[model samples]
Target: MSCQRGQYVTAAVVTAGAISGAYYAYRWYQENATKIPEQWTQVGTLKDIYAYPVKSCGPVIMNKAELSILGLKDGWLRDRFLMVVDEKNNFVTARAYPEMLLVHPSVKSSVLTLKHADMEPVHVNLAEVVTNQCAKTARVWGVEVPVFDCGHETSEWISRILDKSSNNFRLVYYASHGARTLRAGTSKIYRFTKNDTGALPDEVPFNLVNQASVDDLNTRLKETQVTPRNFRPNFVMKGGKAYDEDNWKFVKIGDNVFEIIKPCFRCILTTIDPETGVRNVNADPLETLKTYRQSTEPAARRSAGSSPRMGVQMSLRSAPGGLVKLDDPIYVA
Candidate 1:
């Protein structure tokens, strides 16, 4: 009976070890395995392109744009090129000033025109701003970024539109003072050179949002159905399943190839209505997304607890800098 009990104990220990080993193997696969499937079908076309010259301000819709290594090169390579800063040079956005949504921007040739309903139209010469290389460092998300002060005249114009006192708000252009590098926590899938840089964008140089994903969220909302304007995507893709962009590793739009960096983690800005410049009291879509869209991968998760993600941030890979036109055929690569 003693020998039989000893054998039973040995069997239990082996079984426990096997179970633990299997659990760890599964966890490893979940973190390291490729999310891409064996066959990724072409499920979308580039339906829209938006360039936000100023962060948190209105966007300029385009039919065709040059895709450079940095980002969409539209009008002096001005996607998020200009940002509104406070007296201390801290970045401002619609999150703090909801009225920023009402500011509309349009570009024609060398001119960038800004219009607000309550204020007169403000125009700035894009070439002139680019030529003025006077560098000033400002804070975006608390990181000190080098920028070109757009002169006191342009700063006063923006302050007037924002309804702030003089010297309280200023508009600064990203002057590329030094090599702008990616943050430390980026995934290891892509490479960035010393010359690679970004403007005042929150993270990646470009953001791609699936039309189906927004449609899916609208269906789940209680009262307000949001549009692509609310999400502020550089490329809006059509003909994909809801949230299909999450698995895409790379895609070619027209002549430019883009690599997906990671899924875009959303914030309270989504709950704000772009048209009305008002935020939803209940946080409709974000509350609903947290229930289902949170990432399971360890690298994708921002922290122990963070908001769920919806779209994917992309990086430009094409070297020659080609034109990505409206309705460009999008193919998974």
Candidate 2:
């Protein structure tokens, strides 16, 4: 009986040792085995509280903001909700045509307003504006899109505002705008005013950082005294540790969490501040991006899989235009 007991003890010890070794090895593999990135710890929180109607228009600031699971604000609409398309319904952005950078938009509760500082403000009634049911084909930002145009009134309004011959340009529905996390707006296409800031989105499909990247570019263009607003990020995350958002794949604002989809690409729009609608000499944010942040071969929508695309959208969220408390703990969930 004593000998049997000794054998049992030895066998149990060896088995336990093997199990322990295996566990340790498994942990090691999980830590360093795969190329897939692991969840990065949240060191800070960011609040996205506005939507830029035009691809590079002025911002429609929101008071309460939410984070989305996909990591983009709910306010982000894929195609610019408002645009000046040509005769064939072709679209435009600040990308190739830097002149378009001069146009700025301001959204109020009942109207969509445009500003050019030097030019008078043009307002479009939010109520009269119409939308389409199915997605149609259009092009903006070099990306061919299945875009739907807004109302005929919107086209007329734009024609007069631009003072062009007026062929067949109109507004497009921003798909992301309808993605609301609250019960505020009647539909996804409702107009926003300073008062409606409370209805923020989950996470806009795109995430923008004010200070770091843009500032970095500004430094490169020392002579160009451009404001970060020229870049028109959905929200500006400042006063936190530098680059706090670099690894932030997800963050929560109230009940909203955001998942970053793709990196926002820099365009000629960066050369102009949406606020002043003036040309900026900043280091052409696009020029710097070309060095890095290049796109993949099997690019998504408009990707030639060339030039760099940096801004990434998070999911949208609901908002009362609430304040995001500083140092708000962000979970990786």
Candidate 3:
């Protein structure tokens, strides 16, 4: 009888231990399931906010800008909503005409103004452009996007500034009502959100650069030092380790949250001086970055080739209309 009792006691203890272990496991899961695996870490501060009214032209520096699926905006100004295109409706950038970078664009009330060193400031009535311009398509990065012709005067102004010999260039406005599709090859290469439709930009809507990264690169540069402006990022951040953004997947600024899509690959565009619109003779930054910053991932390497990674391309994860302001604390996860 004692032997049987001992067997029963052993079985009961075993059952009890199993029950305790299971209970603890369940409790642990319950606690952890509701918690985020990665906590947000304070990384940096947004030093400057820029909205490029015209692609590859100049930035309209803002104290604060409203986040949109299309990108950053403030009242009458929007980011990359306007572009200069060739006679063939192909997008023209500072890449072809480095002088385009010197063109400063600004908007106030209903008026869009373009100021260049060589020409008189030309003003376009935004209200009129919206109402009177006809819908058309323009090719950018091999994708055709719906746009509106900003009429003859603006076209002549742009042509005169960009190419005085031929009146072939035209100014076009993004027709927000129409959809801009991404190229299939590009979509396959990068994990892009549904809203990342190429929208006048080369790829994603938002680009962010670490100022410390630029400062770091300057140390390596022999003669030509580049700035965040040369990268043409919408957001510039400081107070972080150089190239800290490479590890970031998501970032929070104020009430806005943005998903980092991929590292922005550096191109010859980075070799151009933002202030002077002149391409570096030695290609200091792009060439230097190529030596150290090439992607190791197979897919990224296939897509980016030897292009060096610099700023990060992003898409807004939070609801549109959140304001991202200068001096805002940036948190990354």
Candidate 4:
């Protein structure tokens, strides 16, 4: 607490002070430099760069996106964005008609637009897109799912959009369980298309990364080579190596905090190229992850939080919470 900048300080005094400072530095390194076990990297953060508005549609780049309890941004344009519902039984889009890709869709305000090569912006009100005056529970991704209908006009409008010289084209409503706990079977049971299962809309998990992990992964792959987008992550970190967040029980970023309860299980979704909507069941980034990142496979045939988790998609606490900007520091309290 007292000034000792002058040569008046004795040689012994200076030596002692230097030793104390070195000791403190060593202690600081010990506290901050240690990496999480099975994770040889430091902590890192990943900012959501692009928001895919309509599921499997297009990516909407955001200046900022809110972090919610479920990782689903409250007012996010990508939150519960677009869904391809089966015209036959009120199901969502999937592999039934792979040509559904030919059907492009967009949304603005309370209206959603569905169009294809020859189709026009078929406007349907979000509030009245379909009407069944009833509820239906269907199996999706091997799980039971319940959804409600929009009403009459919306249904008629959707039918009109896909009905042009079309006999098997129709529209339905998809009730999304945004950012729920990781339930592989549940997700795989809810059907969107014939072979396609439902998604937990806002359900991507938060896989913590550290600086050391980034350095190591980069040492092997280099650059932002293996990207978080590959995992469709809702959060990311660049300051460390991959898989650096293995042992974290909880983490907070900016003003949002999330519980790191379990390892997120991986699925074939990561194999699908979000850009081209192409599917390659093997020889993917997952191959690299499998070499290092696959979590302990579950005991039973299926379980929640038992799959290979890559990121944490927290449940939305507030509708479109607030903005989680780029480079925001994530703190593990």
Q: What is the C-alpha RMSD of each candidate to the true structure, in Å?
A: 18.5, 19.6, 18.6, 18.9
Clashes in model 3: which pairs?
Answer: none
lDDT of 3: 0.80
lDDT of 4 by residue, 1-333 (tens): 332121111343445544653454344334333222231222556545555444434444555775432233333143433443554443443333333434455546545565555444566655443221244543334344444444444455444444433333334334432322344534442221121112335233233434444344445542224445555555556664456566655565655555443455566555555544465555354455555655554432255332344554332211224567777766653
lDDT of each: 0.72, 0.46, 0.80, 0.44
- The model with the greater lDDT, 3 or 4, is 3
Which runs in model 4 stand beyond 4 Å of their true positions?
A: 1-42, 67-78, 87-106, 114-122, 130-139, 142-199, 202-226, 296-309, 316-322
Q: Could you give candidate 3's per-residue lDDT for residues 65-180 as a string of tens digits?
A: 98766788786688998999998999989988998999999998768999998889999977566555566778988888878778788889888888794469988888752226
List model 2 lDDT by residue over 1-333, tens digit each: 111111101323446534643454344334323222244454435544456566544565555443322122223221235555677766655554454556666655535677664556666653333221344555543434444456666566556545553534576543322222333322232222221211122223345564555555556553555555665665566444543454455555434344444445555666565544455554455566566546543534244244555444443323222234333444433
Best-fitting candidate, scored by TM-score: 3
- Which is superior by lDDT, 2 or 4? 2
TM-score, cand. 3 vs. native = 0.87
lDDT of 1 by residue, 240-259 (tens): 89987777788778656666
Off by over 4 Å in 2: 1-42, 45-48, 66-79, 97-99, 118-120, 131-157, 160-163, 174-204, 276-283, 288-311, 316-333
CA displacement after TM-score superposition, residue 207 of candidate 1 (Å)? 0.9
